[model samples]
Target chain A: AQTVTQSQPEMSVQEAETVTLSCTYDTSENNYYLFWYKQPPSRQMILVIRQEAYKQQNATENRFSVNFQKAAKSFSLKISDSQLGDTAMYFCAFPDYGGSQGNLIFGKGTKLSVKP
Target chain B: NAGVTQTPKFRILKIGQSMTLQCTQDMNHNYMYWYRQDPGMGLKLIYYSVGAGITDKGEVPNGYNVSRSTTEDFPLRLELAAPSQTSVYFCASAGADTQYFGPGTRLTVL
Candidate 1:
């Protein structure tokens, strides 16, 4: 079974500051893909960033970046220069293609509040 | 392109009623999925399709049903509505490893 865990249920960060959200996963598959999705008040799910297991270099999309440690099975998201618009729910997901293809296992999520 | 779209932005159903949630994608992706998110929880897979006429059950697919008759449409059917079925449903289409999602359908059962 594949499980993604997000320990912090809620978090807050001041504008222009940096905040890191923690995530861990348990999967037996040697190769896979992980993703971070953001859901704002509008209820639209947006892809924030993605990390491939085989890559050693972390993935960065503008102000969003990931710290992926394959050996420790930890994939954390860092938001640099956070803004008020960054307030949303963040979910860490892992694609479990075991038998059933393209099934994503998602963490409970961390509600992030960006205050000015 | 309209990536992915779902019909009925909001719906209210009574117990024992039946309804189908419509989903379509213009990206021509081979993989489509239906997922539901309960309050304060992450999304759970309901059903998925690899392509036309190839549907499979997902993690939480007991009360829901899905069919993919074409490359662009995957509709999920709810045979009987229940209070537990009240949640937001999302449809997504995958191209490569990335899945693009819809705005989501909010369904409430009274």
Candidate 2:
């Protein structure tokens, strides 16, 4: 039971423009670990960028980039140029490395608004 | 290095009352986690530990109760509180795979 699907609940961009927040997961485990968390409003929970499903390259951190498509299990999160502090609440996590109390499966967030 | 720390950043109970939500970690990470973030949703796993007494049970562990006697402490117990157990409670620690958060604990059960 490894599920993480963030179908964009809310998103907006303008500052510099360029936002892509969408994730999908069901995992059958072939090596796992993918994250993108950013919760502003002081609730601190940063750490935006990480994808390692045997690594196929996709994974940046400067402007945050990720498009891992492990056989379509998809894991997208790219926000380039966008500023305005990037207005937070973006999450798409997974840590079900076959599970053993590794716990970390979230997805139901995407409320970014970088309008200005 | 206050890597992970969760004390009483914010708390308010009433339903049945009973508290204990404090986590600490100086980065001696061996794995420790307990999550819950309800408002807008996204983050639910109520217990974990892989060092010190070894505790487990995630994906929402009933009412909740945890303890990791060492390796930097990991405590989360709410014997009778309800209201869907309010929300906003995060405390994590892990070294071999990224995970270090703790600036959360906004429980409120009225």
TM-score of chain B of each: 0.98, 0.33
Instruction: Please write out the lDDT profile of model 1 over residues B7-97, one tens digit for every residue.
Output: 9999999999999999999999999999999999999899999999999988889888888889999999999899999999999999989
- In terms of lDDT, which candidate is strongest? 1
Candidate 1 chain A worst ten-residue window by lDDT: A96-105
Q: List the residue pairs that clash in candidate 2.
A: none
* Model 1 Cα shift for residue A55 (angstroms): 0.9
State the iRMSD of every prediction, in order shown: 0.7, 9.0
User: Could you say which candidate leads in TM-score?
Assistant: 1
Best by DockQ: 1
| Residue-wise C-alpha lDDT for candidate 2, range A1-116, written one tens digit per residue | 77888988998999988989999999788987898989999988988888889989998989889989899999999899999998999988898877756678889889999989
lDDT of 1 by residue, A3-116 (tens): 899999999999999999999999888888999999999999999999999999999999999999999999999999999999999999999877567878899999999999
Q: List-wise, what DockQ does each model earn?
A: 0.87, 0.31
State the weakest 10-residue window (summed lDDT) of model 1 chain B: B58-67
Worst 10 residues of 2 chain A by lDDT: A96-105
